[model samples]
Target: MNKTNSFRKTIIIASLIFGMLFGAGNLIFPVHLGQLAGKNWLAASSGFLISSGLLPLMALIAISITHSHGIFELAKPIGKKYALIFLVLTHATLGPLFATPRTATVPYTIGIAPLLPGNMQKVGLLIFSAIFFGIVFFLSATEAKITDLIGKILNPVFLLLLFLIFFLAFSNPMGAAKDAAFTASYAHNAFTNGFLEGYNTMDCLAALAFGITVITSICSLGFKREKDVAITTVKSGMFGIFAIAIIYVCLIWLGATSLHDFKLSSNGGTALAQISHHYLGTAGDALIAALTTITCITTVMGLVVAFAQDFHKRFPKISYKTFLAINCLLSFIIANMGLDTIISWSTPVLMLLYPLAISLVILGILSPLYKNDPVVYKITTALTLIPALFDMINTLPEVLRSTPLIQAILSYAERYLPMFHLGFSWLTFSLAGLIIGLIIHFVKQFNYSAVED
Candidate 1:
């Protein structure tokens, strides 16, 4: 009886963690991708999965493997100051500089925008957001009894609402798919675009940040062992992703089918909300709006907690309460800008961050395989950053472009790397770095002396 109860409890804990990772952005983006990708949804989705699914799961695995404080501490092999820079960069990626504010704006766009009178929509958004962020401020200000209950209840309610919504879309698709937006290049181009798109979802970054929380939750339930904790986290992640996978397929297909009736949407958010309002009617729009807001709030809360926790670690003098207050104020401000803009700027940041993120996971996985050597971390990270920097530069606006270095690197990447012409521009360049590092590691190892000879 005792053993059976323990196993059941473990399952529940695992499921909740999975749910936490699968929130607002997760729902919004993939469905939108489906609409654009159409019959090509599968290929595009596979691209989405690389960042959305694989990269994040791997980040958690890296956390478990290192059992370190965060990405900053984990990268101590490099040096402390360098690690802090990585930490600041990651927090900025997830928070005020980009994603954090978007969290607030996204739900507003999806949930509230449709119901308003055409001329009043913008005004309604501004008013609605002020109230929304105020609530975030209050709930975040003090983790009260009500907040705990609300958090627990959100998962089940959100799931129920989503299940109901998707059911409607699947049983009665808006219409058949119209035409692929970028057909010839859609399949191959998808992975890179998907990779870039993954940033907007923000899970890969969140995975590293939230890994400790997952481990702690598992431990609270009386389990220990980093390896076991990691296994559990991965298992839960897979379960959540099971939901993500199904949802993405249906939503993208819905988006594609929507096109026969509607023109090509500017992007996913428009396509999703427009399709929902069209098929599901006024009530459906309201339901989506409410649900999107709920999901986004929870994610925003998670990021808040993470930021506060980091601050507490570095400055013990300032209590968690102080940090929470500060975070809420900042997030409230960021959230007001609206979701559309937040997502726009996140792309270039992803080009900068994704390679380093992939590097951490790859390095962590290969750490044991290589005996956690200083040289491997140093060399591989250096090589990986080169192309990542190049890719970031290649992706920027012309006036925003710095010097000729970016142009020089882009020309070189095109010449040497595979798929460069096809638009795996980012990953192709990274591959060049990966290859160079591996070759150097092998060649250098053999030259080391086995004896004093």
Candidate 2:
């Protein structure tokens, strides 16, 4: 391909990456973090960028370096059974159980729910989600060019609307971001708090699933070699993530400045609505609602299709359409629990899954060093899993966390694990696991070579 054509294709791929990963959680989390971090927004956003921005790019590179077809293949070195379990859990979290459902709830919470009376909000959500998923189902069932639809059409429109909001906010400032007061959680450990808050975006998890689509797109554009594909992925991924990181900073700054007029919101959706209304009134609200819904539709369709296709491949007896319907139906049911409830429940799950996912990403990236050995994969993942479970238990809702069994587990973790209170106890365990696994791998290699001599 010519340089001009190659550059165009690369840009298109970058847009696709941005469209796929920047969905409901991406819209809300940074704004909410800004509100919490207040004057410390810069410190907090740096941490947020690591997990929400850099990690997703790393995930794509991991898939490319390993040449894994999808999430299952990415985890395959751990063992087939473990790969299957990880695949199911990752898809479940990304699909009906959490992320997909949140797609429906976030737009409703931001734009639609505020217009309704208190009692009508629940019914409004039910009606809105039904229509939302109905559209998703129709689009996914068709053999449409979803990648082009999102990258060429919807993402640009969403960006235009979002940029308008940002421009207006910056032009007519609510207050200086540095002048905003920090919430108690962010007062002392804003960076750590922001790091954990980044988990809410779920982009890291989505990156693993979306990696195949990106790689395939690059290959179709005449990049036949593995090295070329990996390089292209890195180029496109950097562009996509750089865009996302910029938006995250802007949204966080918007949130911090909005504190001049509005109090801390219960969630980012609420904060976004308040800001929109303050600047543009009903029109701003409508624009934000449309922007959110458009971004979310792209995401929900992607998640549903990915889930159905993967599950159908695993169980050939089930049709893809059948799996699609099941996912949509389950997501519709869960979305009605409302945005706050979904977020509250999803946190513990993210806490549990992130460490495992991060470990896998690191392992995949470093697989070249270990020669993709199963022994290393098994050891690192096994050690990571233990602390991950504790992280989950520790993050559970207060009511469930107060139970005797859960309390006992948290007490033990807090006492025994470093950085347990900061929600990074897994870091120590994962490092230890990797060291031990590498030592064992080298020792085994040495023994076999000696015997051969």
TM-score of each: 0.87, 0.97
lDDT tens per residue, model 1, 38-102: 66766776778777877787887777777765677667776777778887788777766676677
Per-candidate local distance difference test:
0.68, 0.89
Q: Give the number of the best model, judged by lDDT.
A: 2
Give the RMSD in angstroms, all C-alphas superposed, for model 2: 1.4
Which residue pairs show backbone clashes in model 1? 34-252, 35-252, 35-255, 35-256, 111-289
CA deviation > 4 Å runs, candidate 2? 219-222
| lDDT, candidate 2, at 14 | 92
Candidate 1 lands at a TM-score of 0.87
Candidate 1: residue 57 lDDT (0-100): 74
lDDT of 2 by residue, 51-98 (tens): 999899989889889988678999998999989998899999999999
Question: Model 1: which ten-residue window has the lowest total lDDT?
Answer: 142-151
